[model samples]
Target chain A: MKNAKLRLETCLSPAMYSKHANDDNIVVVVDILRATSTICTALHNGVKRIIPVSTVEEAKAKKDEGYIVASERDGYVLDFADFGNSPFNFTADKVKDKEIVYSTTNGTRCIHMAAHSKAVVVGSFLNLTALANWLIGQDSPVLIFCASWKDRFSLEDTVFAGALAEKLLASGKFETICDAVTASLDLWSLASPDLNGYIQKAAQKGRLAAKGLDDCIEFCHQPDFTSVIPVFADGDLVPVS
Target chain B: MKNAKLRLETCLSPAMYSKHANDDNIVVVVDILRATSTICTALHNGVKRIIPVSTVEEAKAKKDEGYIVASERDGYVLDFADFGNSPFNFTADKVKDKEIVYSTTNGTRCIHMAAHSKAVVVGSFLNLTALANWLIGQDSPVLIFCASWKDRFSLEDTVFAGALAEKLLASGKFETICDAVTASLDLWSLASPDLNGYIQKAAQKGRLAAKGLDDCIEFCHQPDFTSVIPVFADGDLVPVS
Candidate 1:
């Protein structure tokens, strides 16, 4: 490592996007609570493709094209949404061989922000090792942009970013790192093995669990449960086959 | 601890000021490399006051009022400046009972940005214990805004913030914390008992060392070297008597 050839940086929240989050870097957007976890789980179970639209209107627009609309607002299913963004709803029996047009309050917006990156990939604890393996094979710099709860720093999303940052740092593939990335790595190290307990007690857990999706918290914590990598390109998330 | 009554947040770089950096929070501006360290050192040696002006013109303007002008640009003393920002120059013999008006490339600018806060205080490794004690006595939310190198995050300022954050988190005064503060705490824990060695390998060390200020780095690394707290009020940095 030339200590400068490859660098790792993290945006603790997409709302904190500075010019440093340029299009030149490979962006791994992490929304561990549900969105990315759900997408990865759906893809691992043989979902055809996912349209990560920015708005519920856009997702519903894709509904006429035989895409199952999945949307959530404030952690609940929207009025007309077929399914809320929860991994519990993304089972192999239901979503296999189907298309999903998904939109959420925060995750979808973050995914749209990644449209200008060199490449956009979804990551969560559910596919931690799988995404880390894929990211390690890339030549470009990496940016982990956390889709925090409505731009406020959520504990779960940051811990997820920290987990990925730890993997990237340990690979010794990068020479330079920003403070946020370093902090994430330290946080991950501080809360290992008990990651589920950490998420269960996260400040955001009250708001999420209050929404009656406590199971989503548990479901998202299963690390490396799937080998599928859901990549965003051409405005849709497709398995990197 | 109400856990929500007092919150701690950190801006890794002054340039990364987000809307979450509320003006209502008590801002503790940290520049541990040499600026805050020098201020603590000078005040400890019985300096009357420090005027941390943002512009060279403002500092020069204060010169007419019999205040000693100290300024630095690009890690070296400006040609006409009375002194550069270095702890080596702030000794009891040279600065005792004197009024110093100082400006630096990055630290002073960060101090000026603290004007909107409920109160602004300077923090460094030198006054770490004293500053933490004072802040723990406060009831308001705290923000540790690190004055990094220019607009980017520097390794030194953040480490100082991390040190303070760890203290604050342990004090049981805070009810909530953002990821930045948590990360800083972890960083501080990871570098304990060897802060000097950590500073020696910092990314910013190369630039300062190249300027022949290696002695200054060593001086700033000495934790608890001072008991004075420099508070920014009415546009000047005055010792909190």
Candidate 2:
């Protein structure tokens, strides 16, 4: 692989996270419905720094320190937390200049799992191009690690990964895509034309819509909606300038 | 789920297998390139039973009991085995009227892991309609478990699963489809017209071509190439007559 060209590959779920040789590659964890997407939107909305924690206990600890703890389980806001893991609450009126301790059912766990990678980035349709452009300038392979719906393959995350992959592929910087990457790229192409119709019927659709989080879905579904490239560095999520 | 309609979901790899609640569902294990495809071809050629084992040692134990042992690793046929796990070798002249024991790098392990399920069936593009028709006849939910290339997602298996899912959905037997299923179904629709063109660039392509197993690729790519339905029953693979 030393002599090979730069590549774009996707790990569909955290379960397949171990299958990737991501030690040398940049990983973009995509949890489009909606943790990663929410983080991206929040960063774009000027939240100071987002700390993605693994457990509710970890989130609560930071809450005691004055950080607003946002925790979600099964697509609803935790009774003890300040907010849900939805981007609707990430508007400037709410989270501007604030530090958020975020914990979600699936997405935060994915962020922690990829903490040791060369670099971990949060991806969504919100910041799709920004994420892709940053990766194109890198010299190593790029692994789009989709933080699927609870270790199960989720369409929204895969679609976001596919969007980033498509952007990178169009730039002609990463051409050596694996089969899974190809499949996702194809899926993104198919879904791009009518994304709302496609994602509204997604696997993770009911969990949020049932909780009246359709606003979160519409917020995250906007293509190239935000330019905030939220990168996980030194255990915190910060915008990459 | 009794009052609700039967759903069809797909697990793209064994990595995603644990994500499935398949205890009540019938899992159709698919490994188009080529374990499931090969097993379907073999059963079509009148192979009485296919004992899918997880290890070379287990395959050899079956060999000692007069089973025609087939083993493959890294796309190569083991010296002690009668043949490699390729559909091209499952011609009528070789496997007809035989009871075979098979073990491959990824697919067999998936079969063994899913043994405790209510019932497991082998699926491939070759028996796409047959597999879908059988599922439509049943009332239970169906899980298309793709035996991905070593716990990682593979395009061929996913495409096969999508094709079957497409068929099932069209029959109106399965209305509740998950995110992965929708992705695969869309992928299948996109790749259906030029499947060979799509699969030839699959992740497993170079590995098999490097090992001179390109014949396996051509054989497995044929859509609805055969009508045999190989179902895992009584701990063995047998054709559904």
Candidate 3:
């Protein structure tokens, strides 16, 4: 049901999340460069549940416990991990019904930061429309939390935020008085015409491109690639039932 | 001489200032709704120097000491203040040749936050062009610091940062890879065409409007209204000699 009273706001970085956090608001954690995208893809491809930890050491500990782990830091696959943060790494053959532990430089930290919200759901361009629809169905206000690059703004996450905010606003169910939301909506309007080209200017895109691991950049921005909504429940991300 | 190597960045809020702060950079403190704008107008109107205090209690103490004090909190003049933060209150007859103590809800604190930078200067649409020109002549990288509303994003400050950054970048002496800069520049591009209309959406505007104190909103965005760059030196804002 549409609720005109529900506010939509965007937190530009995870570091700023505390100011925007509300126990009743649904927080949408976004790390469109790869982490959230990978989570969405992993769940869609039949992964049972994923444990997201903040530190690489925690991920290693989870791995030693016999859990399949996917770890990355600064865009590189950890030597002890089974996979990096690429959505491709979570294909059905490798991840089907497996419980994977995931960690990244920025994304996973945000999911944990927003753990206190009414519901913390993972968002990526791949699940943009689906997440928006899910949010519209809920009664809570929506806070789009960008897992920015190490507490600094990341163009890709913000652009994806703008994309999702645009969808939410279009539903006529949400409104915003936040400058961050207004700015993101404008950024989305500007970047949506040529997303691949637009993302080329992102600092993260350059970071991943320099590492030769940006093959997933295009895939990450592919809207509606999956309809799965990864919700954090009891320390694991499982698709909504 | 122009240095292509010099990078320009925008810190969207004073809360996020430390992440972008550098001992070698020039930090331009901006609070476009009124505080910084009032500072520029105060200095330009021949106020000897303005001492900025962070708290209302500090401002009251300064007032008790016989210093002319301008104090505001949440868009209203404090009961003990001789003046509010409106730029119009600093006319030559009233503030000329007198040292005034100032405190505001957001901007003064930001001025203090960037005090450790190589240089901390005030920027507003009022001094946009002159501030950009002066920054181009400096050898250090630039950080545009926005005194956002209580550590949240403010559309007015980011838009002004964009306006200042646009001029700096146009000089060809500055370049930026930071997403905040790119986002600001894009916002400036969009907001430049209709600034008053653009700023109408700011949450701060609504706050000021509700109090009937929004008359200065148009005056605040009038570009290059004065060229008096208020640089912080030895605890006071004085014009560049």
Number of the top candidate by TM-score? 3
Q: Per-residue lDDT tens digits of candidate 1, residues B58-122?
A: 77788777778888877778777788888777778888888888887567777777778888899
Candidate 3: residue A101 lDDT (0-100): 91
Fnat of every candidate, listed in order: 0.27, 0.92, 0.57
Per-candidate TM-score against the hidden true structure: 0.86, 0.93, 0.97
Q: Please write out the lDDT profile of model 3 over residues A1-241, one tens digit for every residue.
A: 7435788999998667778989998999898888899999999999999998889899899989999988887777899999888888999999998989988767777877788889999999998898989999997899999888768888888888899888888888888889899999888888999999988988888888899988999999999999999999998899987
Candidates' lDDT values, in order? Answer: 0.78, 0.81, 0.89
Please list the residue runs of candidate 1 whose C-alpha ends up more than 4 Å from where it truly belongs after superposition: A1-5, A56-67, A150-155, A169-172, A198-201, B1-5, B56-67, B150-159, B169-172, B198-201, B210-214
In model 3, where do residues sit more than 4 Å from their true spots? A1-4, B1-4
**Is 1 or 2 the stronger prediction by TM-score?**
2
**Tens-digit per-residue lDDT, A1-241, candidate 2:** 4455686788888888898856888888888877888898888898999988877788778877888888877666777789887787778988999888888767777777877788888888888777777888877788888877778888888777777887788876677547778878788888889988878778577876777776777778887888789988878899986
- In candidate 2, the residue pairs with backbone N, CA or C atoms under 3 Å apart (3 or more residues apart, or in different chains) clash, namely none
Report, to 2 decimal places, the DockQ of model 1. 0.30
Model 3 lDDT, residue A211, Cα: 94
Return whichever of 1 and 3 wins on lDDT.
3
**By TM-score, how accurate is candidate 2?**
0.93
